[model samples]
Target: MRAQIGDRLVLEGTHLGDARRVGIVIAVAHDDGSPPYEVRWLDTGRATLIFPGPEARIESQPPVADVSGPA
Candidate 1:
């Protein structure tokens, strides 16, 4: 699967447990938006990241980032 930044990777009621987190795509993997993405999520005020495999289906896709905001 391919997804831009700000995509929410929810494991849902799958085997990964009922873990729910929302993180921004701080960084991309390759030139193309594929798997193994480094997602910086907010967990209890901590930013967690992981290189999830592309095989994992995305539950939802968030809107692309807006540079209009303060950088």
Candidate 2:
């Protein structure tokens, strides 16, 4: 798995009826965009280093630009 800063990590529940967890990639630990990313959980706003498992998936967002002014 690979990710960049600002990518969203979705962690599916292990068992039935478990609550899903969502986090954002705050920092990438490796140069190759590998695992062990520093993520901040949306639920609690807490940050931690995580090695994602099979239940985890990443949602990469496109770069944002200033669209307020005329093109």
Clashes of 1: 0
Give a tens-digit lDDT track for model 1, residues 1-71: 76567676553334465665556565667768776666666665444556665334454554568879887
TM-score for each of the candidates: 0.51, 0.90
RMSD, candidate 1, Å:
5.1
Report the C-alpha lDDT of model 2 over 1-71, residue by residue, as the tens digit.
Answer: 99999999999999999999999999999988899999999999999999999999999989999889986
Clashing pairs for predicted structure model 2, backbone only: none
The TM-score, computed over Cα atoms with residue i paired to residue i, of candidate 2 is 0.90
**What lDDT would candidate 2 get against the real structure?**
0.96
**What stretches of model 2 exceed 4 Å from their correct place?**
68-71
lDDT per model vs. reference: 0.59, 0.96
Q: After superposition, how far is residue 13 of candidate 1 from its true place, in Å?
A: 4.2
